[model samples]
Target: MLAAAALAIAGVAYSSWIFDFIVPTGQDRFRSFLSELEADDVPWHQVYSYGDIVAGVAAVGASLLLFGVRPAGRGATTAVVALGVFGTATVADALAPMGTVPIVHAATSAIAVFSLFVTMGAATWSAFREDNWPIMRTLGATTFALVAIATGWMLGSDRLQGDYLLGLAQRIQVGAMSVWLLVFSVGTWSSTRHARRPKRVPRRR
Candidate 1:
């Protein structure tokens, strides 16, 4: 499901570029903010908006499954909430376009991005706690840390040349998160019965 979400996200992003719906995402002349694609009444922006909504909804399902698989774990709960927030933001973001309602759009974007960071942390901690999936844990933690750093740098570089890198930074963050989620999803849902089950909480040593 998370993979589907990632595909939906990438589809719209690529569509935007293919149709020239907005400036190319990573160029200096291009704005990094996803809202810009739909905010200014760009043509067929509803397509982009709805694409985000699809991604968000799929993520919500994946999160819910995580929650269901391990309701007792605090990490699972946190992941649920974080991804839920991300899903909510996408809906709110689509409803409030930047041009018609700048404040609402900005608020939703901030909320979504913030939730994304939290989601990464929660996912990393959850996988890292499991000894069986060493590779998954390592990749999750590494991606989480690196994306967190990039997000921080992007947030901190206000009014500087660093701001110019916002496009790249934002993509990096999204891409990293997508990779972690995709890999984690695949691992969790592996065809092997042993791998299909969620990792249970280890007993107290």
Candidate 2:
């Protein structure tokens, strides 16, 4: 799922550059948001469209798998629900391209970001009761902090219309979220792998 997300983002970035839709090096960089690439006039817009669809599908499956396993605590359950919301919002973004449905696209994207924030917070809380969960908790906490700070900065400043900071904040939030999910996946995989060990057979009597 993380790989799909990374690739989709890469595809979008590449398409944006190729089409001159967002020249990151230019003065207009601050005004260049991700959604603009999804506009109808952009060249090769379908790449981002289809890539997000694939990523969203992958996210849905991954979230369900994570949720199905060991949902034994409130924090863990919250994480699961947040994960599902993240997937749903991702799919919603894919279905409603910015050009075709700008309002819906923006709304879903906002929800997705909120869901990701909750996911990390829940994971951090859930990790407190499990062995070897410190690393996961630390990761979750760090990611949450970066995103929260960046988002707050974006909201605190109106210069996003004229400065590059908003774009920087946006990338930081998105990138950190993806990295956090990768860490979560690895930690969960390790835990489940060790958790299912079978009992030793009784010695012959």
Query: Number of the top candidate by lDDT?
Result: 2
- On residues 64-169, what C-alpha lDDT tens digit does candidate 1 reach at each position? 6655565335664676678778877867877888878888888988898788778667656666663333445666577777778767756655457633667556
lDDT scores for all predictions?
Answer: 0.61, 0.64
Model 1 — TM-score against the truth?
0.72
Off by over 4 Å in 1: 1-32, 130-135, 161-163, 191-205
lDDT tens readout by residue for model 2, 84-178: 78777877886897778889998998897788778778878888863434567677577768878877876654354555466556655555666
Off by over 4 Å in 2: 1-30, 129-134, 158-164, 197-205
Backbone clashes under 3 angstroms, per model: 0, 0
Q: Please, what is the TM-score per model?
A: 0.72, 0.75
TM-score of 2: 0.75
CA error at residue 74 for candidate 1, angstroms? 1.2
